[model samples]
Target chain A: MRFNDKLRLAWKKNNSLVCVGLDPDLSRLPAGMAQQRESIFEFNKTIIDATHDVVCAYKPQIAYFSAYSAEEQLEQTIQYIKTHYPDIPVILDSKRGDIGSTAQKYAVEAFERYQADAVTINPYMGFDSAEPFLNYQDRGVILLCRTSNRGAGDIQDLIVDGVPLYERVADLVANQWNKHNNCLLVVGATWPEQMAKIRNIVGDMPFLVPGAGAQGGDVEQLVKAGKTADGTGLIVNSSRGVLYASNGPDFVEAARNEVIKLRDLINQFR
Target chain B: MRFNDKLRLAWKKNNSLVCVGLDPDLSRLPAGMAQQRESIFEFNKTIIDATHDVVCAYKPQIAYFSAYSAEEQLEQTIQYIKTHYPDIPVILDSKRGDIGSTAQKYAVEAFERYQADAVTINPYMGFDSAEPFLNYQDRGVILLCRTSNRGAGDIQDLIVDGVPLYERVADLVANQWNKHNNCLLVVGATWPEQMAKIRNIVGDMPFLVPGAGAQGGDVEQLVKAGKTADGTGLIVNSSRGVLYASNGPDFVEAARNEVIKLRDLINQFR
Candidate 1:
């Protein structure tokens, strides 16, 4: 199935749009699991088990796993999710961009090696960097438009022909780059006004909205600005806020509670 | 020593500006080694051994390793160079960029996990994305400015303030972003005019120039446009042309010869 259809099914079945970012920081891991060889996968398994039914998607930040030489754990985490909760899609939030040949290898890393349902890419390299991933046809290629960070405006807001660069990116992705229907924009929840403008530009194209909880993005404003006409076009993400809600034994349950709260809050606005 | 001083020392010691890219494609490996478990490392070892003296740097594209779950091989490759030929810097051509917290993890993945002396980054996310890497005061952070690929102009050529975006990137990296003196710009050899323009903007800042050999970039044009006033601020890279110069057992010698030829040709222009 196409990533869009799979995502929509997940949204309907779970009645949510929350995406839990599995960024397992070793220093912040629970006391007992930090020293274990397979701690990342083990912790992720617990979180996925607890929140699988409550959330629409899982986004594993590749940096956290790669930082500790835990690519094996990342593979295990994704495999565990596919085996146990096949309905929920996984987005590998890699934000990778390169020239054509190098970008092809990255595509293999995200799709074949990791077996992610969708992957986020940086649009800085332009179309060839994105073309290899879009060739997957079914996988989602989420391009960073206006990121959730404070310094996102450094390049994203550069005015070109009287419109911000991010708006041009939105128009280009929606009109020219979405020929395969596999492209999506990353319009951060922290910038609701920009999100609304992007929504206007791209119509009902899905958005992978980061910066909800830990990044101080208000759920009400995000939903109001980013929702499609049918009210289901956003995958709202919360990483540290949801993953490390508690550092103790109840971390798994705390994570689940946070996901539920975020899902319900987003739905309330929708 | 800082990356700039180390790079200049390599240039003076080796009398070369060549940076041989270590992008090992599985299908393109020499006939016998393709099926071996340690082929990536073994191949890189031979290439590095043969060309290390003729080159100023070694750039291992991480995607080539990570795609085949060969991160350990990448680690071995960089470690081999550091142990045996410490003067020749290793640039991890990752092209990574993300928000601040996530970017920190990527910095660890490059500088800590791989122990690369320098790493390439995509500048689309702006200053904060480049900050964590710069915090490693001794390491080199190369940002993408004008890429070699034909589609580089898709977003890079977008006019902002009556100048192309790549020029703006060059100005920013040369002035504001180089406070740590750890930043370099990636200017492709495929476009000499743009490279000359970037040279005007950035003055004598170093450039990691790709697309020389297999990518059909001319050595003379690249050197004329990109060299600093002192003629030593460029690391010209050739990947497939040097690495896979021959499919036979003479591949190692062929690689060395190609590197010598490229080095001499670049010096001729200088």
Candidate 2:
């Protein structure tokens, strides 16, 4: 299935807009969860099992896996998700950008090798850096725009022509690069006004909204500003808030509870 | 030993300005080589052995290794380089960027897991995205500036205020971020004028200039425009032109010959 089709199906079936991030920091893992690949995989497996129904997608940050040389564990975790929760697509959050040749290898790494349904890319180098990912006609390529951090305005908010850089990015992606119809934009939920502006520019292309949880974004405002007419155009991601909910033995349950609450809150807004 | 110190030592010792990219594409590998991690490592070993004397640094693009699930081979290759060619710093060409927490993981991946001396990063998300990589006071954090590709100007050349965006990036990196003296910038050999302009802006900062060979960038102009007063500010990289010099069994020798020609050409211009 195409990435958007699968995402639409998952959204309808689960009635959710939550994208749980599988970012496992060694220092932040539960007590007794030693810094090993096996523990990380096990923790991910438990979290996946607990929150599958509440999630529209699973976004695994590549840095967490690459940090420990736990790529095998990451692969296995994706496979486990595919085998068990087949409808929930896996988005590998690797903001990779390079020239054409290097971008091709990254495409292989994200799509063929890791079997992720979608991937994130940085748009600094413009079309060439994102072309390889967009060539995957069945996959989704999410580009960073209006990111959710303090210093994001340093460059992203730079005025070009008459509009900010992020709006220019949205215009470029919406008008120029969405030929394949598989492109998405990442607008942080913390900037609801910008997200609303971007939503107007991009029409209905899904926005992978981060910063809805520990990053201190208001979920209701984000949903109100970012949702499409059908109320299915946002993937509100909560990584630390969901994954590290409780360091105790009931961490999985706590994560499940947190995702359930976030999903319901998003649905109520929808 | 700091990264720049090691790079300077190698540049002076070898009297060369070539950075050979280890972008081993599986389809481009020599015939009869089995598709296994061991074979990949062996191919890299042969290539490194042949080009170590002629090149100043060995840049292994992370995408190529990650594509074939050969990250172990990448690890082993870096270890081999450290043991065998200690002075030649290994720059992991992973243009990684993310938010603060995710960026932290990427820093761990580049420094702790791979143990690379330097790394390439994308600055699209602004300062916070580059902050985690910059926090590594000992290692080098090379930011992407004017890229070598054709469409690099789509966003990079967009004029803001009165200057182009890339010059603005140079200003930011030079004035704000190089406090630890571990910052570098990427300027494409394809745009020698821009390279020279950037060179003038950031007086002595090292420029990782790609697009020398296969990308049709002129070597003499690049060397002349990119070199510092001491003739040691440009690390011109040629990947496919060196690696795919010949598809025959004499590939290593052919690669060495190509790199030698590039190194001598750069030195002649110097």
Candidate 3:
């Protein structure tokens, strides 16, 4: 299935827009969690099994697995996700943006090797850097617009031609990319006000909106900022706010509940 | 030996400012001269053998090698350089710039995996993204400032708080990075005026100046633009113009002559 259609189906079947960020920080894993080589795969599988019906996608931050000597484990983690959580979209949050050749290698890693449904990419290198991802018709390439961080404003909010860099990026990710393949723009819920403007600019490209929970972004305000005639194109991601809700044995169940609550609130707005 | 000291010694031995670019285009190699799989390494090895002592450094553009599926061959090619030409600085021309964790992975790839003496990095990510690279004091992180490309002025020349983006990067690479590790800057030879201005901002941080030969950059103007007090901070590079000097069986000899010619002209100015 096309990534967008699969995402739509996943969103409806799960009754949620919550994406579990599998950022397995070795030091930050729960107190009693063992440090085995396959600990990440084990942790991720449990979370997927418990919360499969309460989440739209799984977002894996590449850093956590890349830090160790067992770097091959990252490939195994993705293989497990593709096998067990096959229906749910996996967004490999790599944030890569380089020249044409290196960009091509990353495209292979995400699509051919890891088989991620979508991947987060940095847009600093301009159109040439992103062209490789746009070649995959069945996948989604989420370009960073206004990221959920303090320093995002340092560059994302810069004014150029009376438009913010994020808005300009939204236009490019919409117009230029659609000519080739699927594209999504990342808009943080913290900057809800920018969401409405971005929605209007990009028309209806799917938005992977992050920062809806512990980051303290107002959910109601964020929903108001992103409402379209079709109310679809929004994936409000909550990682730490849900996955790390409780560090005990009930962590996955606690995560499911948090997702359920957020989904209910979002359903009301829809 | 430390990277800086090795670079200085190599420069003294070479009496050459030239940094031969190993941008091995697979199709351009001599017929049956090893197929595309290991052609890049095969070609690079021949060039290095003929002219290793004539150049201070060897710059391998990340895109060229990445364009092929021979990741293993690329790794082997680099290992070959590090093994045979240990003193010849191999600056991996990968303009990678991303967030903290991913940046750390790239540092691991460039420093540990490929074992480059210096890796060109992108500075659009700001200091935090670059901090991971700076933490590796044993290596050199060359930040891209004012590039030699036509579209470079699109972003790098942007003024903020009374200083250009390139100037801001230079200031940050000099001040913030020196706090942790050794840092260098990339100032393209095509932009002599920007090179002179960036030299002032970055002081004596070695500038990997590309764009002299096939790229139509003026070497004499570049030599004038980047000459340091000790005549040490410029490693002006020529890629296709030097490496592709001839396509026949005598290609290596022709390639060596090209390097010798460029090196003589640069030394004359010095």
Q: Pick the candidate with the highest lDDT.
A: 1
Residue A61 in model 3: shift from native, Å? 3.3
Q: Write the per-residue lDDT of candidate 2 for residues A133-220, one digit (tens) a residue.
A: 9999999999998899988898888889989999999999999999999999999989999999999999999999889999999999
User: DockQ scores for all the models shown?
Assistant: 0.87, 0.86, 0.26
lDDT of 2 by residue, B80-116 (tens): 9999999899999999988898898899889998899
- The window of 10 residues in a row where model 3 chain A has the poorest summed lDDT is A63-72
The CAPRI-style docking tier of model 2 reads: high
Predicted structure 3, TM vs. truth: 0.81
TM-score of 1: 0.99
Q: CA lDDT of each candidate? A: 0.93, 0.91, 0.77
In candidate 2, stretches whose alpha carbon ends up further than 4 angstroms from where it belongs are none
lDDT of 3 at A196: 88
Residue-level lDDT of model 1, residues A1-270, one tens digit each, is 999999999999999999999999988887678565478888899889999999999999999999999999999999999999999999999999987889999999999999999999988888998999999999999999999988899899999999999999999999999999999999899999999999999988999999998889988999999999888999999899988899898888899999999999999988
What's the lDDT for candidate 2?
A: 0.91
Clashing pairs in 2: none
C-alpha TM-score for every candidate: 0.99, 0.98, 0.81
Q: Point out the higher-scoring one by DockQ: 1 or 3.
A: 1
How big is the positional error of residue B111 in model 1, measured in Å on the Cα after superposition? 0.5
